[model samples]
Target chain A: MGKKVLIIDDSSTMRKIVTRSLRQAGLDFDTILEAGDGQEALQLLAKESVDIILSDINMPNMDGIEFLRQKSANAAIKSIPVVMITTEAGADILAEAKSLGAKGSIKKPFTPEQVSEVLGGLM
Target chain B: MSWETHIADATVEIFSTMLMMEVSSQPPLTERIKSHQDSVTGMVGMAGLYKGMLAIHAPSQVAMTITGNFLGLEVDSVNDDVKDAMGELANMLAGSIKAKLSDNSKDIQLSIPSAVCGDSYSLDYQPQQGSSMVPFESAGGRFLVELQLEQQT
Candidate 1:
Protein backbone atom coordinates (compact mmCIF):
# COMPACT_ATOMS: atom_id res chain seq x y z
CA MET A 1 0.00 0.00 0.00
CA GLY A 2 1.08 3.55 -0.65
CA LYS A 3 2.16 5.70 2.30
CA LYS A 4 -0.65 8.23 2.66
CA VAL A 5 -4.11 8.29 4.36
CA LEU A 6 -6.85 10.88 4.53
CA ILE A 7 -9.10 10.82 7.61
CA ILE A 8 -12.28 12.87 7.34
CA ASP A 9 -14.55 13.23 10.37
CA ASP A 10 -16.17 15.98 12.39
CA SER A 11 -15.31 14.36 15.69
CA SER A 12 -11.74 14.89 16.83
CA THR A 13 -12.12 12.02 19.26
CA MET A 14 -13.06 9.61 16.53
CA ARG A 15 -10.30 10.88 14.30
CA LYS A 16 -7.72 10.26 17.00
CA ILE A 17 -9.07 6.81 17.79
CA VAL A 18 -9.01 5.82 14.13
CA THR A 19 -5.50 7.12 13.76
CA ARG A 20 -4.38 5.09 16.74
CA SER A 21 -6.08 2.00 15.38
CA LEU A 22 -4.46 2.53 12.02
CA ARG A 23 -1.10 2.54 13.65
CA GLN A 24 -1.91 -0.44 15.83
CA ALA A 25 -3.11 -2.33 12.78
CA GLY A 26 0.39 -1.82 11.38
CA LEU A 27 -0.67 0.21 8.34
CA ASP A 28 2.39 2.41 8.25
CA PHE A 29 1.90 5.53 6.20
CA ASP A 30 4.27 8.40 5.70
CA THR A 31 1.43 10.92 5.63
CA ILE A 32 -1.86 10.99 7.56
CA LEU A 33 -4.25 13.89 6.85
CA GLU A 34 -7.25 15.17 8.78
CA ALA A 35 -10.42 16.95 7.67
CA GLY A 36 -13.40 17.93 9.76
CA ASP A 37 -15.95 17.63 6.97
CA GLY A 38 -16.37 16.60 3.38
CA GLN A 39 -15.84 20.10 2.06
CA GLU A 40 -12.56 20.41 3.91
CA ALA A 41 -11.63 16.93 2.76
CA LEU A 42 -12.32 17.80 -0.84
CA GLN A 43 -10.19 20.86 -0.48
CA LEU A 44 -7.35 18.80 0.96
CA LEU A 45 -7.80 16.24 -1.79
CA ALA A 46 -7.55 18.90 -4.46
CA LYS A 47 -4.15 19.98 -3.15
CA GLU A 48 -2.66 16.56 -2.45
CA SER A 49 -2.74 12.92 -3.46
CA VAL A 50 -3.64 10.23 -0.96
CA ASP A 51 -3.82 6.48 -1.29
CA ILE A 52 -6.85 5.92 0.94
CA ILE A 53 -9.71 7.92 2.45
CA LEU A 54 -11.28 7.08 5.83
CA SER A 55 -14.45 9.08 6.39
CA ASP A 56 -17.57 9.36 8.47
CA ILE A 57 -21.06 9.55 6.99
CA ASN A 58 -22.66 12.14 9.26
CA MET A 59 -21.09 15.60 9.54
CA PRO A 60 -21.91 19.27 9.47
CA ASN A 61 -21.00 21.55 6.51
CA MET A 62 -20.86 18.58 4.16
CA ASP A 63 -21.51 14.93 4.94
CA GLY A 64 -19.60 11.94 3.60
CA ILE A 65 -22.38 11.12 1.12
CA GLU A 66 -22.01 14.47 -0.58
CA PHE A 67 -18.25 14.11 -0.48
CA LEU A 68 -18.39 10.74 -2.19
CA ARG A 69 -20.90 12.03 -4.69
CA GLN A 70 -18.73 14.93 -5.68
CA LYS A 71 -15.62 12.81 -5.67
CA SER A 72 -17.24 10.25 -7.91
CA ALA A 73 -18.18 12.96 -10.36
CA ASN A 74 -14.59 14.07 -10.58
CA ALA A 75 -12.48 11.71 -12.68
CA ALA A 76 -9.28 12.78 -11.01
CA ILE A 77 -10.42 11.80 -7.49
CA LYS A 78 -12.71 8.90 -8.36
CA SER A 79 -10.22 6.07 -8.21
CA ILE A 80 -9.07 6.49 -4.62
CA PRO A 81 -10.79 4.04 -2.29
CA VAL A 82 -13.04 5.65 0.34
CA VAL A 83 -13.81 3.61 3.44
CA MET A 84 -16.69 4.82 5.57
CA ILE A 85 -16.66 4.68 9.36
CA THR A 86 -19.99 5.39 10.99
CA THR A 87 -22.34 4.52 13.82
CA GLU A 88 -25.30 4.37 11.44
CA ALA A 89 -25.91 0.89 10.01
CA GLY A 90 -29.26 1.55 8.44
CA ALA A 91 -29.66 -0.33 5.18
CA ASP A 92 -30.54 2.73 3.18
CA ILE A 93 -27.34 4.58 4.03
CA LEU A 94 -25.23 1.53 3.41
CA ALA A 95 -26.80 0.98 0.00
CA GLU A 96 -26.45 4.60 -0.89
CA ALA A 97 -22.78 4.67 0.07
CA LYS A 98 -21.94 1.53 -1.89
CA SER A 99 -23.85 2.75 -4.88
CA LEU A 100 -21.86 5.94 -4.71
CA GLY A 101 -18.68 3.86 -5.11
CA ALA A 102 -17.40 3.42 -1.57
CA LYS A 103 -14.91 0.61 -1.45
CA GLY A 104 -15.99 -0.60 2.00
CA SER A 105 -17.39 0.42 5.40
CA ILE A 106 -16.57 -0.14 9.08
CA LYS A 107 -19.24 0.46 11.66
CA LYS A 108 -18.60 2.53 14.79
CA PRO A 109 -17.64 1.06 18.18
CA PHE A 110 -15.35 -1.06 16.09
CA THR A 111 -12.38 -2.98 17.44
CA PRO A 112 -8.78 -2.98 16.36
CA GLU A 113 -9.25 -6.39 14.82
CA GLN A 114 -12.28 -5.23 12.90
CA VAL A 115 -10.41 -2.20 11.65
CA SER A 116 -7.54 -4.34 10.51
CA GLU A 117 -9.85 -6.82 8.85
CA VAL A 118 -11.63 -4.16 6.80
CA LEU A 119 -8.55 -2.19 5.86
CA GLY A 120 -6.61 -5.30 4.94
CA GLY A 121 -8.62 -5.80 1.79
CA LEU A 122 -8.43 -2.21 0.67
CA MET A 123 -4.85 -1.46 1.63
CA MET B 1 -42.27 2.04 22.69
CA SER B 2 -42.32 2.41 26.42
CA TRP B 3 -39.43 3.63 28.59
CA GLU B 4 -38.95 0.14 29.97
CA THR B 5 -38.30 -1.41 26.59
CA HIS B 6 -36.04 1.41 25.45
CA ILE B 7 -33.87 1.10 28.52
CA ALA B 8 -33.65 -2.66 28.21
CA ASP B 9 -32.62 -2.61 24.56
CA ALA B 10 -30.11 0.21 24.90
CA THR B 11 -28.29 -1.30 27.85
CA VAL B 12 -28.14 -4.66 26.20
CA GLU B 13 -26.86 -3.39 22.89
CA ILE B 14 -24.28 -1.00 24.34
CA PHE B 15 -22.81 -3.62 26.60
CA SER B 16 -22.89 -6.31 23.98
CA THR B 17 -21.44 -4.31 21.12
CA MET B 18 -19.25 -1.61 22.61
CA LEU B 19 -17.68 -3.08 25.71
CA MET B 20 -17.84 -6.68 24.59
CA MET B 21 -19.51 -7.28 27.91
CA GLU B 22 -22.90 -8.66 28.87
CA VAL B 23 -24.98 -6.98 31.56
CA SER B 24 -28.32 -7.85 33.04
CA SER B 25 -30.25 -4.92 34.49
CA GLN B 26 -30.66 -5.87 38.08
CA PRO B 27 -33.97 -5.38 39.86
CA PRO B 28 -35.19 -2.06 41.28
CA LEU B 29 -33.08 -2.81 44.31
CA THR B 30 -30.04 -2.42 42.13
CA GLU B 31 -28.13 0.68 43.12
CA ARG B 32 -28.71 3.84 41.12
CA ILE B 33 -25.30 4.89 39.90
CA LYS B 34 -24.02 8.28 40.98
CA SER B 35 -20.42 8.92 40.06
CA HIS B 36 -17.68 10.28 42.32
CA GLN B 37 -16.71 13.91 42.97
CA ASP B 38 -15.56 14.57 39.43
CA SER B 39 -16.68 12.43 36.53
CA VAL B 40 -18.02 12.77 33.02
CA THR B 41 -21.21 11.90 31.16
CA GLY B 42 -22.55 12.37 27.67
CA MET B 43 -26.20 13.20 27.17
CA VAL B 44 -28.62 13.81 24.33
CA GLY B 45 -32.10 15.16 24.84
CA MET B 46 -35.04 15.10 22.48
CA ALA B 47 -37.77 17.73 22.61
CA GLY B 48 -40.21 16.97 19.82
CA LEU B 49 -41.73 13.51 19.37
CA TYR B 50 -40.01 12.40 22.55
CA LYS B 51 -39.30 14.76 25.42
CA GLY B 52 -36.58 12.95 27.30
CA MET B 53 -32.87 12.91 27.99
CA LEU B 54 -30.46 10.01 27.55
CA ALA B 55 -27.24 10.15 29.51
CA ILE B 56 -24.15 8.01 29.96
CA HIS B 57 -22.63 8.66 33.37
CA ALA B 58 -19.43 6.98 34.46
CA PRO B 59 -16.72 7.44 37.03
CA SER B 60 -13.32 8.62 35.93
CA GLN B 61 -11.85 5.15 36.34
CA VAL B 62 -14.63 3.44 34.47
CA ALA B 63 -14.60 6.10 31.79
CA MET B 64 -10.88 5.64 31.33
CA THR B 65 -11.24 1.90 31.08
CA ILE B 66 -14.07 2.22 28.57
CA THR B 67 -12.18 4.80 26.57
CA GLY B 68 -8.99 2.81 26.48
CA ASN B 69 -10.81 -0.31 25.38
CA PHE B 70 -12.76 1.52 22.69
CA LEU B 71 -9.89 3.54 21.29
CA GLY B 72 -7.09 1.01 21.72
CA LEU B 73 -5.14 3.41 23.87
CA GLU B 74 -3.59 3.20 27.27
CA VAL B 75 -5.56 6.18 28.42
CA ASP B 76 -5.29 7.35 32.02
CA SER B 77 -7.60 10.34 32.08
CA VAL B 78 -11.12 11.15 30.90
CA ASN B 79 -10.87 12.76 27.51
CA ASP B 80 -12.79 13.13 24.28
CA ASP B 81 -12.91 9.37 23.96
CA VAL B 82 -15.13 9.00 27.00
CA LYS B 83 -17.28 12.00 26.15
CA ASP B 84 -17.93 11.00 22.56
CA ALA B 85 -18.61 7.38 23.34
CA MET B 86 -21.17 8.30 25.93
CA GLY B 87 -22.71 10.90 23.64
CA GLU B 88 -22.72 8.54 20.69
CA LEU B 89 -24.33 5.82 22.72
CA ALA B 90 -27.19 8.14 23.51
CA ASN B 91 -27.56 8.93 19.85
CA MET B 92 -27.67 5.26 18.91
CA LEU B 93 -30.20 4.41 21.58
CA ALA B 94 -32.38 7.34 20.64
CA GLY B 95 -32.21 6.43 17.00
CA SER B 96 -33.13 2.87 17.80
CA ILE B 97 -36.10 4.03 19.79
CA LYS B 98 -37.14 6.39 17.01
CA ALA B 99 -36.96 3.61 14.46
CA LYS B 100 -39.11 1.44 16.68
CA LEU B 101 -41.66 4.07 17.62
CA SER B 102 -42.42 5.95 14.41
CA ASP B 103 -43.15 5.24 10.81
CA ASN B 104 -41.40 8.40 9.71
CA SER B 105 -39.31 10.88 11.71
CA LYS B 106 -39.76 13.85 9.42
CA ASP B 107 -41.36 15.76 12.31
CA ILE B 108 -38.94 14.65 15.00
CA GLN B 109 -35.39 15.91 15.28
CA LEU B 110 -32.58 15.21 17.75
CA SER B 111 -30.25 17.63 19.46
CA ILE B 112 -26.56 16.87 19.32
CA PRO B 113 -25.20 14.92 22.27
CA SER B 114 -23.02 16.80 24.75
CA ALA B 115 -20.93 16.06 27.85
CA VAL B 116 -21.31 17.10 31.47
CA CYS B 117 -19.24 15.62 34.27
CA GLY B 118 -17.93 17.03 37.51
CA ASP B 119 -17.87 16.63 41.27
CA SER B 120 -21.05 18.57 41.99
CA TYR B 121 -24.03 18.34 39.68
CA SER B 122 -27.72 19.00 39.69
CA LEU B 123 -30.33 18.65 36.92
CA ASP B 124 -33.75 20.16 37.57
CA TYR B 125 -35.80 18.86 34.71
CA GLN B 126 -39.42 19.64 35.41
CA PRO B 127 -41.40 16.64 34.40
CA GLN B 128 -42.80 17.18 30.94
CA GLN B 129 -46.59 17.14 30.60
CA GLY B 130 -46.06 13.37 30.80
CA SER B 131 -42.67 11.74 30.96
CA SER B 132 -40.81 9.02 32.85
CA MET B 133 -37.30 8.20 33.94
CA VAL B 134 -35.55 5.20 32.41
CA PRO B 135 -32.21 4.21 33.87
CA PHE B 136 -29.45 2.03 32.40
CA GLU B 137 -26.56 0.16 34.06
CA SER B 138 -23.59 -1.59 32.61
CA ALA B 139 -21.10 -3.86 34.36
CA GLY B 140 -18.83 -0.97 35.27
CA GLY B 141 -21.23 1.84 36.28
CA ARG B 142 -24.77 3.14 35.82
CA PHE B 143 -26.43 6.02 33.97
CA LEU B 144 -30.03 7.07 33.40
CA VAL B 145 -31.81 7.77 30.12
CA GLU B 146 -35.19 9.37 30.59
CA LEU B 147 -38.17 9.64 28.24
CA GLN B 148 -40.97 12.18 28.34
CA LEU B 149 -42.99 11.39 25.31
CA GLU B 150 -46.43 12.97 25.36
CA GLN B 151 -45.71 14.70 22.07
CA GLN B 152 -45.28 11.85 19.59
CA THR B 153 -48.92 11.11 19.07
Candidate 2:
Protein backbone atom coordinates (compact mmCIF):
# COMPACT_ATOMS: atom_id res chain seq x y z
CA MET A 1 0.00 0.00 0.00
CA GLY A 2 1.18 3.52 -0.73
CA LYS A 3 1.87 5.92 2.17
CA LYS A 4 -0.49 8.75 2.98
CA VAL A 5 0.09 12.06 4.79
CA LEU A 6 -2.11 14.73 6.38
CA ILE A 7 -1.34 18.45 6.72
CA ILE A 8 -3.32 20.69 9.09
CA ASP A 9 -3.13 24.48 9.11
CA ASP A 10 -5.54 27.41 9.15
CA SER A 11 -4.12 29.37 6.21
CA SER A 12 -4.88 27.99 2.79
CA THR A 13 -1.71 29.69 1.53
CA MET A 14 0.32 27.89 4.13
CA ARG A 15 -1.32 24.62 3.24
CA LYS A 16 -0.30 25.12 -0.36
CA ILE A 17 3.22 26.09 0.70
CA VAL A 18 3.54 22.99 2.83
CA THR A 19 2.34 20.84 -0.03
CA ARG A 20 4.90 22.44 -2.28
CA SER A 21 7.64 22.03 0.28
CA LEU A 22 6.81 18.37 0.71
CA ARG A 23 7.20 17.89 -3.01
CA GLN A 24 10.47 19.83 -3.02
CA ALA A 25 11.80 17.80 -0.10
CA GLY A 26 11.27 14.61 -2.05
CA LEU A 27 8.91 13.20 0.58
CA ASP A 28 6.58 11.43 -1.75
CA PHE A 29 3.22 10.38 -0.42
CA ASP A 30 0.71 8.62 -2.57
CA THR A 31 -2.09 10.56 -0.89
CA ILE A 32 -1.96 14.03 0.66
CA LEU A 33 -4.82 15.32 2.84
CA GLU A 34 -5.50 18.72 4.36
CA ALA A 35 -7.49 20.17 7.29
CA GLY A 36 -8.13 23.78 8.33
CA ASP A 37 -7.65 23.30 12.04
CA GLY A 38 -7.45 20.72 14.80
CA GLN A 39 -11.19 20.19 14.89
CA GLU A 40 -11.27 19.70 11.18
CA ALA A 41 -8.24 17.42 11.38
CA LEU A 42 -9.92 15.28 14.00
CA GLN A 43 -13.05 15.00 11.91
CA LEU A 44 -10.96 14.04 8.91
CA LEU A 45 -9.05 11.52 10.98
CA ALA A 46 -12.26 9.76 11.96
CA LYS A 47 -12.94 9.03 8.34
CA GLU A 48 -9.50 8.73 6.73
CA SER A 49 -6.33 6.94 7.71
CA VAL A 50 -2.93 8.58 7.19
CA ASP A 51 0.52 7.36 8.06
CA ILE A 52 1.79 10.71 9.34
CA ILE A 53 0.66 14.25 10.04
CA LEU A 54 2.22 17.71 9.73
CA SER A 55 0.47 20.51 11.62
CA ASP A 56 0.71 24.15 12.63
CA ILE A 57 0.62 25.15 16.30
CA ASN A 58 -1.58 28.28 16.20
CA MET A 59 -4.98 28.07 14.51
CA PRO A 60 -8.64 28.96 14.91
CA ASN A 61 -11.20 26.55 16.49
CA MET A 62 -8.60 24.01 17.67
CA ASP A 63 -4.85 24.56 17.96
CA GLY A 64 -2.16 21.93 17.50
CA ILE A 65 -1.60 21.25 21.22
CA GLU A 66 -5.27 20.58 21.83
CA PHE A 67 -5.38 18.52 18.69
CA LEU A 68 -2.55 16.38 19.99
CA ARG A 69 -4.39 15.99 23.28
CA GLN A 70 -7.58 14.93 21.58
CA LYS A 71 -5.83 12.71 19.09
CA SER A 72 -4.04 10.85 21.88
CA ALA A 73 -7.31 9.94 23.56
CA ASN A 74 -8.78 8.38 20.45
CA ALA A 75 -7.48 4.85 20.07
CA ALA A 76 -8.19 4.79 16.38
CA ILE A 77 -5.84 7.67 15.51
CA LYS A 78 -3.54 7.70 18.52
CA SER A 79 -0.75 5.87 16.76
CA ILE A 80 -0.34 8.32 13.88
CA PRO A 81 2.84 10.33 14.29
CA VAL A 82 2.59 14.13 14.18
CA VAL A 83 5.21 16.77 13.31
CA MET A 84 4.56 20.46 13.91
CA ILE A 85 5.45 23.07 11.28
CA THR A 86 4.92 26.42 12.92
CA THR A 87 6.30 29.90 13.53
CA GLU A 88 6.61 29.09 17.24
CA ALA A 89 10.12 27.94 18.19
CA GLY A 90 10.06 28.51 21.95
CA ALA A 91 11.27 25.71 24.16
CA ASP A 92 8.15 25.76 26.29
CA ILE A 93 5.66 25.20 23.47
CA LEU A 94 7.86 22.78 21.59
CA ALA A 95 8.51 20.88 24.83
CA GLU A 96 4.80 20.71 25.49
CA ALA A 97 4.26 19.38 22.00
CA LYS A 98 6.96 16.76 22.61
CA SER A 99 5.26 15.73 25.82
CA LEU A 100 2.04 15.31 23.92
CA GLY A 101 3.60 12.67 21.64
CA ALA A 102 4.72 14.82 18.71
CA LYS A 103 7.33 13.00 16.72
CA GLY A 104 9.28 16.09 15.64
CA SER A 105 9.07 19.69 14.43
CA ILE A 106 10.07 21.97 11.55
CA LYS A 107 10.16 25.68 12.28
CA LYS A 108 8.65 28.27 9.97
CA PRO A 109 10.86 29.99 7.33
CA PHE A 110 12.45 26.60 7.07
CA THR A 111 14.36 25.24 4.12
CA PRO A 112 13.72 22.08 2.17
CA GLU A 113 16.85 20.55 3.69
CA GLN A 114 15.55 21.26 7.18
CA VAL A 115 12.25 19.63 6.35
CA SER A 116 14.01 16.61 4.93
CA GLU A 117 16.33 16.34 7.90
CA VAL A 118 13.54 16.28 10.48
CA LEU A 119 10.97 14.23 8.57
CA GLY A 120 13.33 11.89 6.78
CA GLY A 121 13.58 9.53 9.71
CA LEU A 122 9.93 9.79 10.61
CA MET A 123 8.84 8.70 7.15
CA MET B 1 21.60 43.96 19.66
CA SER B 2 18.51 46.17 19.35
CA TRP B 3 14.96 45.66 18.15
CA GLU B 4 15.98 47.17 14.83
CA THR B 5 18.61 44.50 14.39
CA HIS B 6 16.15 41.80 15.34
CA ILE B 7 13.58 43.01 12.86
CA ALA B 8 16.10 43.29 10.07
CA ASP B 9 17.63 39.88 10.72
CA ALA B 10 14.27 38.18 11.02
CA THR B 11 12.84 39.76 7.91
CA VAL B 12 15.91 38.99 5.87
CA GLU B 13 16.02 35.42 7.07
CA ILE B 14 12.36 34.80 6.31
CA PHE B 15 12.49 36.30 2.86
CA SER B 16 15.65 34.47 1.98
CA THR B 17 14.69 31.09 3.32
CA MET B 18 10.98 30.92 2.56
CA LEU B 19 10.51 33.24 -0.35
CA MET B 20 13.78 32.30 -2.03
CA MET B 21 14.45 35.99 -2.47
CA GLU B 22 17.17 38.23 -1.19
CA VAL B 23 16.17 41.47 0.53
CA SER B 24 18.50 44.15 1.78
CA SER B 25 17.49 46.24 4.76
CA GLN B 26 17.91 49.99 4.64
CA PRO B 27 18.54 52.21 7.67
CA PRO B 28 15.57 52.54 10.03
CA LEU B 29 13.10 55.29 9.25
CA THR B 30 13.05 58.32 11.56
CA GLU B 31 9.24 58.55 11.52
CA ARG B 32 6.53 55.93 10.98
CA ILE B 33 4.64 56.15 7.70
CA LYS B 34 1.01 55.77 8.71
CA SER B 35 -0.67 56.18 5.34
CA HIS B 36 -0.39 53.71 2.50
CA GLN B 37 -1.41 53.86 -1.14
CA ASP B 38 -1.80 50.99 -3.53
CA SER B 39 -0.39 48.71 -0.88
CA VAL B 40 -1.16 45.85 1.47
CA THR B 41 -0.40 45.71 5.17
CA GLY B 42 -0.12 42.52 7.20
CA MET B 43 0.10 42.60 10.96
CA VAL B 44 -0.13 40.72 14.26
CA GLY B 45 -0.65 41.87 17.84
CA MET B 46 1.19 40.76 20.99
CA ALA B 47 -0.03 41.05 24.57
CA GLY B 48 0.99 40.10 28.13
CA LEU B 49 4.52 40.83 29.37
CA TYR B 50 4.90 43.09 26.35
CA LYS B 51 2.21 44.65 24.20
CA GLY B 52 2.94 45.46 20.59
CA MET B 53 2.21 45.00 16.94
CA LEU B 54 4.38 43.82 14.05
CA ALA B 55 3.39 44.79 10.56
CA ILE B 56 4.67 44.42 7.02
CA HIS B 57 3.55 46.85 4.34
CA ALA B 58 4.14 46.25 0.68
CA PRO B 59 2.96 47.73 -2.58
CA SER B 60 0.35 45.77 -4.49
CA GLN B 61 2.73 44.82 -7.24
CA VAL B 62 5.46 43.90 -4.76
CA ALA B 63 3.00 41.86 -2.71
CA MET B 64 1.90 40.01 -5.83
CA THR B 65 5.49 39.29 -6.64
CA ILE B 66 6.06 37.96 -3.15
CA THR B 67 3.00 35.75 -3.43
CA GLY B 68 4.27 34.54 -6.74
CA ASN B 69 7.64 33.56 -5.30
CA PHE B 70 5.98 31.98 -2.29
CA LEU B 71 3.71 29.69 -4.28
CA GLY B 72 5.83 29.37 -7.41
CA LEU B 73 3.01 30.88 -9.43
CA GLU B 74 2.29 34.17 -11.16
CA VAL B 75 0.06 36.36 -9.01
CA ASP B 76 -0.96 39.58 -10.72
CA SER B 77 -3.42 40.94 -8.15
CA VAL B 78 -3.61 41.51 -4.41
CA ASN B 79 -6.14 38.83 -3.67
CA ASP B 80 -6.72 36.41 -0.81
CA ASP B 81 -3.42 34.66 -1.46
CA VAL B 82 -1.51 37.91 -1.20
CA LYS B 83 -3.25 38.84 2.04
CA ASP B 84 -2.63 35.44 3.61
CA ALA B 85 0.98 35.35 2.51
CA MET B 86 1.65 38.78 3.97
CA GLY B 87 -0.17 37.90 7.20
CA GLU B 88 1.87 34.76 7.56
CA LEU B 89 5.00 36.86 7.18
CA ALA B 90 3.86 39.10 10.01
CA ASN B 91 3.06 36.07 12.12
CA MET B 92 6.52 34.65 11.55
CA LEU B 93 8.14 38.01 12.30
CA ALA B 94 6.12 38.39 15.50
CA GLY B 95 7.09 34.90 16.60
CA SER B 96 10.76 35.77 16.19
CA ILE B 97 10.33 38.92 18.24
CA LYS B 98 8.35 37.04 20.87
CA ALA B 99 11.16 34.53 21.27
CA LYS B 100 13.52 37.41 21.98
CA LEU B 101 11.21 38.95 24.57
CA SER B 102 10.70 35.89 26.78
CA ASP B 103 11.58 32.25 26.96
CA ASN B 104 8.16 31.13 28.12
CA SER B 105 5.70 30.86 25.29
CA LYS B 106 2.84 31.80 27.59
CA ASP B 107 4.58 34.99 28.68
CA ILE B 108 3.19 36.65 25.55
CA GLN B 109 0.16 35.87 23.45
CA LEU B 110 -0.11 36.62 19.73
CA SER B 111 -3.37 37.48 18.06
CA ILE B 112 -4.47 36.07 14.75
CA PRO B 113 -2.84 37.67 11.73
CA SER B 114 -4.74 40.26 9.67
CA ALA B 115 -4.30 42.25 6.47
CA VAL B 116 -5.47 45.54 4.95
CA CYS B 117 -5.26 46.79 1.40
CA GLY B 118 -6.59 49.52 -0.90
CA ASP B 119 -5.69 52.51 -2.99
CA SER B 120 -5.31 54.62 0.13
CA TYR B 121 -5.55 54.00 3.88
CA SER B 122 -3.87 54.97 7.12
CA LEU B 123 -3.11 53.02 10.30
CA ASP B 124 -3.55 55.08 13.43
CA TYR B 125 -1.48 53.87 16.38
CA GLN B 126 -0.05 55.80 19.30
CA PRO B 127 2.55 53.59 20.90
CA GLN B 128 3.42 54.48 24.47
CA GLN B 129 6.86 52.92 24.54
CA GLY B 130 8.94 52.31 21.43
CA SER B 131 8.48 52.07 17.68
CA SER B 132 10.68 51.31 14.70
CA MET B 133 10.13 50.97 10.96
CA VAL B 134 12.64 49.40 8.67
CA PRO B 135 12.63 49.51 4.89
CA PHE B 136 13.85 46.70 2.67
CA GLU B 137 14.59 46.47 -1.03
CA SER B 138 13.75 43.41 -3.08
CA ALA B 139 14.10 42.80 -6.78
CA GLY B 140 10.51 43.79 -7.44
CA GLY B 141 10.32 46.84 -5.14
CA ARG B 142 10.55 48.11 -1.56
CA PHE B 143 8.52 47.38 1.60
CA LEU B 144 8.43 48.39 5.24
CA VAL B 145 8.39 46.35 8.44
CA GLU B 146 7.17 48.22 11.49
CA LEU B 147 7.29 47.27 15.16
CA GLN B 148 5.40 49.06 17.93
CA LEU B 149 6.11 47.78 21.42
CA GLU B 150 5.48 48.72 25.06
CA GLN B 151 6.63 46.67 27.99
CA GLN B 152 3.90 46.00 30.55
CA THR B 153 4.36 46.08 34.29
Q: A6-121 in candidate 2: lDDT tens per residue?
A: 99998888899888888899998899999999999999999999999999998989999999999999999999999999988889999999999999999998988898898899
**What are the runs in model 1 whose C-alpha is more than 4 Å off?**
A20-30, B1-6, B20-24, B28-37, B45-53, B72-81, B95-110, B124-140, B145-151
What is the i-RMS of every prediction?
A: 3.5, 0.8
- Which docking class does model 2 fall in? high
Q: Is the docking of candidate 1 incorrect, acceptable, medium or high quality?
A: acceptable
Residue-level lDDT tens digits of model 2 in B1-153: 989999999999999998999999999999889999999999999999999899999999999999899888999889999999999999999999999999999999988899999999999999556699999999989999999999998
lDDT of 1 by residue, A76-113 (tens): 99999999997556666768899999988887767667
Worst 10 residues of 2 chain B by lDDT: B124-133
Model 1 residue A48 distance off true place after TM-score fit, in angstroms: 2.7
How far out, in Å, is residue A54 in model 2? Answer: 0.5
Query: In model 2, how large is the Cα lDDT of residue B120?
Result: 100
Please report the candidate that would top TM-score against the real structure: 2
